[model samples]
Target: MQSLLEQLFAGITTKSAEETERIARAFAMLVPVDTTLAFHGDLGAGKTTFIRGLARAWDIVEPVTSPTFNLYTLYEGSRQLVHLDAYRLDSGADLDSLMIDDFIRSPWCMAIEWPERIADSLPEETWHLYLGINDQQTHTIRLRL
Candidate 1:
């Protein structure tokens, strides 16, 4: 059988939020701590749902929600999980002003939504994932490594 990452790279279609979260949970097992994930998707594409799975993998008990209005939210579990939303930002400098790095602890993973808004602020090694809604209303997620 192919690795979860391999299957994700090939693209996976999720028919529901649970399926999307399951895929993300599997993908989280393959990711290293202190990683950065850039999520690209239109509204209602399941980006936050996927991150909720990641949080679950980390044993986070708190509810996971998009940080759209707050810009970022940090959750503590076995490791730190930082959720960032860059939809309102016009440039990377705006991201820099948030002082996000100061809040990050070691062994952390940062998942960013609307990452295109802060492309220049992201590390070169950031893993990119694209989620899209198909005509059938299912969501497809693909990794771009």
Candidate 2:
């Protein structure tokens, strides 16, 4: 049998935002307390939606939104959740200027959207997920293991 991570990454397609969230909730349970998740996808590919699911699993009560403008947002609950959007970042150095580490607490997870913009800044163990939208409007998510 495949490991839990393998099963989750075995190619999942979600027809709705709710389904995507469900998958994220399941994923949140499997990851370590201190980890980073890098989300890769095009516009309207449900990257934020998947992160919303992760927030739900962590019992975060605040709204989870894309930090395209502010660059990042932090939510505190049973565990800390930091959402980062690097679409506008010029380089990994831009990421370093944010001083995100100062805001992070223990047992926290950081979810990065548009991580490619700051690829060099990501930790070696960061988990990467790719999301895509099909012609039928369904969303596909797969792990880059």
Candidate 3:
């Protein structure tokens, strides 16, 4: 069977941060509580922007920001959001120190940035999203199930 990721993001592009967020919000409606997203992209490629849209769709009132300095940030509402940034993490051990499993096993949904930094630690079925910048400064978003 075709996977959800493959169905949702085979080829999608957005012209602005707002558009990206709108698309992300639309997709967020289909996510389950256990869903985990692995986001891959360069800086300013609209990863966080898409996340902001997700938070809005999830009805989270708090702001969404890159967790680079804090490592991870959790937002709570109807359902919890565990935002993780692995940019500074060096290994799976580093990820373990964050007690990532606790979040993964919880009712909360997770969205991880720079997931390549801890690829070994990701859940087997984690959904993958890739964001790229085009010549027109738009974002091209792809997904892998």
Q: Which has the greatest lDDT?
A: 1
Please report, as a residue range, the 10-residue window in candidate 1 with the lowest summed lDDT: 88-97
Clashes in model 3: which pairs? Answer: none
TM-score: model 3 vs. ground truth: 0.87
* Regions of candidate 1 where Cα sits further than 4 Å from its true position: 92-94
- Model 2 lDDT per residue over 34-121, tens place: 8999999998999999999999999997888888678788998778999998888765455568888887889999899989888887
The C-alpha RMSD of each candidate to the native structure, in angstroms, is 1.4, 1.7, 3.0
What local lDDT score does residue 43 receive in model 2, on the 0 to 100 scale?
Answer: 88
Winning candidate number (TM-score): 1
- Backbone clash numbers for all candidates listed: 0, 0, 0
By lDDT, the candidates rank as: 1, 2, 3
lDDT of each model, Cα atoms only?
Answer: 0.88, 0.86, 0.81
lDDT string for model 3 (83-145, tens) is 988888766544567886765545567899898998887888888889999955578899877
- State which candidate, 2 or 3, has the greater TM-score: 2
lDDT of 2: 0.86
Ranking by TM-score: 1, 2, 3
lDDT by residue (tens digit), candidate 1, 1-145: 9888888899998898999998888888888888999999998899999999999998998989888578788999887999998887665455568787787888999999999988887888899999999955599999997
